[model samples]
Target: MSTDTGNDARQQWKAWHEERTETVSAPYGPLALTGTYWIADATEGRIPAIPGHWAVDGENGERGGAVLLTATAADGLTVDGRPLSGTVRLTADKGPAAAARADHGGRKLVVIRREGLWAVRVYDPGSAGRRAFTAIDVFEYDEDWVSPGVFRPYDSRRRVSVRNADGRERGLGLDGELAFTAAGSGFTLQVGVEVDGTLWAVFADGTSGDGSYRFRFLRTPAPGVDGRVTVDFNRALLPPCAFADHFICPCPPPGNTLPIVVPAGERRVLLG
Candidate 1:
C-alpha cells in the first residue's frame, strides 16, 4: 500500500512538471523577454526595439517618477486600442504582460518600477531565447526527497535585501519560516505566504552549480494549524532567470543553503 501511494504521488508530480515546462515555453513566457531598458539610460528618449519617444514624466527625462510616452501615428503605438499620439502619462504597469500600458506591432511594452527606478520591459514573441527553448532537465522522481514540515508565522512580515540574478540587489519579504527534515538533517527556510495560501521558498543545495542549477524554488500548500505541510523537493522549479537573462529573479536568502547534495527536482536548463 505504501509503495502504491508513493508511485501515485510520483506520477502526479511528473504531470505537474510537464505542465510547468509547457508554461515556460509559452509565447509570452520569460524566454520571450527581449530587453529591459531603463528610462535614465536612454538620453535620446528612445528605447531599443520599442517604437516611441519614451521620456520621463519629470525634469529633462530624469526618472523622477513615472514615464511620459510620446507616440505618433507613424510610431503605431496604442493604448486600449486607441492610436497613441502626442504625450500620455503612464504609471508603471502593475498588471500582467497582456495588460501593459502600451504596445505596438503585437509586442508588449511593460513598464516596471524597481528600487525607485523606472524601466520598460519589452516582451517580443520572436525573442531568440524563446525560439531556441527546448526543455527543462529534471532529476528522476524520488519519493525519499519528500517530507512533512512545520510552518511558524511571525506577528509581522519582514523584508531582506538579497542579490538578484541580474547582479542587482532587491528586497525579498518573508512571512515566516518552514522547518523540515531531509536526508537525516533538519533545515529551516524563510518563506513568503502567497494569497492562495501557499508558501514559496528559494533555496540552494550542495548540488548547486555542480549537478544542478545554482538555485531552485519550491511552492507548497500553506501549513495547517498544527504547522503540518508537505515539502516535496521533487517539485523544485527553476527561476525565471534560468529561462532568460533579462529577468531579475531574487537569489536565495541567508541560511537557505543546504550542506547536503539534493539530487532531486529540476536541475538545469537543457537545450535541445
Candidate 2:
C-alpha cells in the first residue's frame, strides 16, 4: 500500500483504540461490573452485597423467566427516576446498564438471563476494578494484520458445549465459519451470527496467555452479498472477562485457536 494510505489507516486505528479505551472505562462498562448474583442463591430476596430483595417468578428455578424485586424507601432503589418501595417485575435488560430500570445510588442493577437462569449484574461506577484500571495494552496497528476473508454459512445453526470463564459449561451457538489467510497461512474460525448479520469470534493465538490475554474476541461487520469481509486483527478485543471476573465470556471452541502468533490487537488490561 502507498504511504498515504497506510498513514490514514494507522490514524483511524489510533482513533478506534482511543474509543475502545473510553468505552471500557465508562461508568457501566466491563471494568465497572462488580458482581453477577444468581437469583437462585438469594435468601429471602437478599443477594449478598447487593441491596434489596430479589427473586424469580414464572419458571420458578428452571426455564426462562422474569425477575421479581422488592424494595423499600430505605433501600434507596430507584426505577425510572422514581424511588421504588414495592415489588416490581423485570425482564432481562435489553439496553445499556445505565438505562436499566433499577438503580441504587450510582449503581445499575441489570437483570440478565442466560441458559434459562436469571441473575442480576451490578455495575457500580465506584467499582474497584474500574478505579484501578489504567489502560488496555495493545500492539501498534500493522497493515499486514488485515486480510480478506470469506464467510461460509452452515446448513443450520449449531450449538456446542463450551466452557465459560466462570468455570461452568454452556451452549455456544454458531452459525458460520470465517476463513482467511494471515501471515502466509490459511486459518478458519467458527463464528456466531448476530441478528444484524455481523459475526463474532472467540479465538486464541500463539500469544494468548503469554504475551496477550488468555483469549480475545473479534467482530466483523456484515459480510457482502458475496460473503466477503475484512478480517482485521489489529482490532481484536480483550473479552469482557478479562476486565471483570463476573463476566462469563466463553472460551474458544475447538479449532478456533490459531497456531500462528497474532502479534496485533489488544493484549491485556493494565491496572494500577
Candidate 3:
C-alpha cells in the first residue's frame, strides 16, 4: 500500500511537470517576453522599438494609474479586436499576455503596474529564448521532500524591501510564516498570502546558484482552518526570471533562505 501511494504521487508530479512545461513554452509565456518599458522613461511619450506613444493619465502615474496611448492604423496596433487609429486609455492588463487589451500582430503589449509604477511588456512569439528552449530540468519526484506544515499569520501584514532580479529594490509583503520539518530538521519560511489564501514563498537553498536556479518559488495550498498545510518541495518552481531576463522577480527575503541542500525540484532551464 505504501509503495502504491508513492507511485501515485510520482505520477501526479510527472503530470504536473508536463503541464508546466507546456505552459511555459506556450506562445505568450515568460520566454516570449523581450522587454519591459516603464512609462516614466519614455522620452516624448515614445518607447524605443515599441509602436504607439504612451504616457501616464494620472498624476505622476501613481497607484490606480492608466496609460494614454496614441497610435495610427499604419502602426498595426489593435485594441479589443479593432484597429486603433487614435488615442486610447488603457489600464493595466489583468490577465495573461495573450489576453491583454492591445496587440501588434502576434505580439502582446501588456500594461502592468508595480508599486505605483506603470510599465509595458512585449511578448513576442518569435522570441529567441522560446525558439531555443527545450525543457526545464527537474529532479525526480521524492516523497521524502514533502512535509506537513503549519501556517502562522501575523497580527498585521508587513512589507520588506528586497532586491529584484533587475537589481532594483521592491516591497515584498509578508502575511505570515510556514513552519515545517523535513529530515528531522525544522524550518520556517516567511510567506505571503495570495488573494485566494494560498501561500507564496521565495527561497534559496544550499544548492542554489550551484546546482539549481539561484532562487525558486514555492506555492502551497491554502491552509485549513487549523492552519494545517503541506510543504511539497517536489513542486518547487523556477521563477519567471530564470526563463527571461525581463522578469523582475523578487529575491528571497531575509531569513527565508534555507541552510539545507534541496535537490528534489526544478533545477534550471534547459535550452538548445
Candidate 4:
C-alpha cells in the first residue's frame, strides 16, 4: 500500500509540474508581461506607448464605474484586435493576459481594475524577460515536506499595510494562522483568505535571496470545518515578482518569514 501511494503521489506531482511549465511559458503569462502602467503615473491621462486615455470614475468607495478607454483610427488602436473606438467598461483581469484579446499590432493591451482604480498592461512578445528565460530551476519533490496543518483564526481579522513591488503601500488582509510541524520543529504562518476562502501565504525561508528567490507563495485549499489542511512545502512556488520586476507582489510580513531553510521547492530560473 505504501508503494502504491508513493507511485500515485509521483504521478500527481508529474502532472502538476507539466501544468506549471505550460502556465509559465504561455504567451502572456508572467514572462510575457512587458509593462504594467498605473494610471496614476500618466500626467496627461495618456500611458506611454499605450493608445488610450484612461481615468477612474465612480463614487469614492463604490465598485461600479467605467474606465474611459478612448481611441480612434488615427490612434491606430484595436480592442480585441478590432479597431477600437468609444469607451469600454472594464473589470479586473481575472486570468492570464494572453487570454486577453485587446491588441494594437503585436502588443497585447490588458485592462486591469484594482480597488476601483484602472490601469493598462502592455504585453509584447519581444519582452526582455521572456527572451532571457532559459529554464526554471526547481527542486525535486520530497514527500517528507508535505504534512498536515491546522488553521487558527485570530480574535479578529487583522490588516497590515505593506509595500507592494510597484512601490505603493496597500492593505494586505489576514484571516488566520496556519500551523504545521516539519523536521521536529513546529511553525506558524499567517495567511490571507482568497475570494474562494482558500488560504494564501507569501513567505521567505532561510534560502530566500540566497539559494532561491527572495520569496515564495503557498496556497492551500479551504480548510476543513476543524481548520485542518495540507501544508505542502514541496509545492511552494515562486511569486510573479521573481519573473518580472513589474509585478506588484506583497512582501512577506515580519512573522511570515520562516527561519529554517526550505530546500524542497522551486528556486530561481536560469536567465540567459
lDDT for predicted candidate 2 compared with the true structure: 0.93
Candidate 3 TM-score, C-alpha based: 0.98
lDDT of 1 by residue, 86-152 (tens): 8888898877787786888878888898877788998888888888888899899998899999999
lDDT, candidates in the order shown: 0.87, 0.93, 0.94, 0.80
Which scores greater on lDDT, model 2 or model 3?
3
Tally clashing residue pairs in candidate 1. 0
Residue 206 lDDT, candidate 2, scale 0-100 = 96
Ranking by lDDT: 3, 2, 1, 4
Off by over 4 Å in 2: none
Error of 2 at 76 (Å): 1.0
* Between candidates 3 and 4, the lDDT winner: 3
Which pairs, if any, clash in model 3?
none
What's each prediction's clash count?
0, 1, 0, 0
Question: Which segments of candidate 4 are over 4 A away from where they belong?
Answer: 59-64
Instruction: Give TM-scores for every candidate, taking all chains together and pairing residue i with residue i.
Output: 0.92, 0.98, 0.98, 0.90
Candidate 1 TM-score versus the reference: 0.92
Encode model 4's per-residue lDDT on 1-272: one tens digit a residue. 38889789878977887788677766777887878887767767788878777665566522446555777777777776678877765556667786675677777787786666667888877888888888778888888888999999888889898777777887788889999998779999999888897899989989999989988999888999999998888778888988888788998876989989888778887788
lDDT of 3 by residue, 1-272 (tens): 39999999999999999999999999999999999998888888998778889988976654546999999999999998899999999999998899999999989999999998899999999999999999999988989999999999999999999999999999999999999997789999999999999999999999899999999999999999999999999999999999999999999999999999998889999999
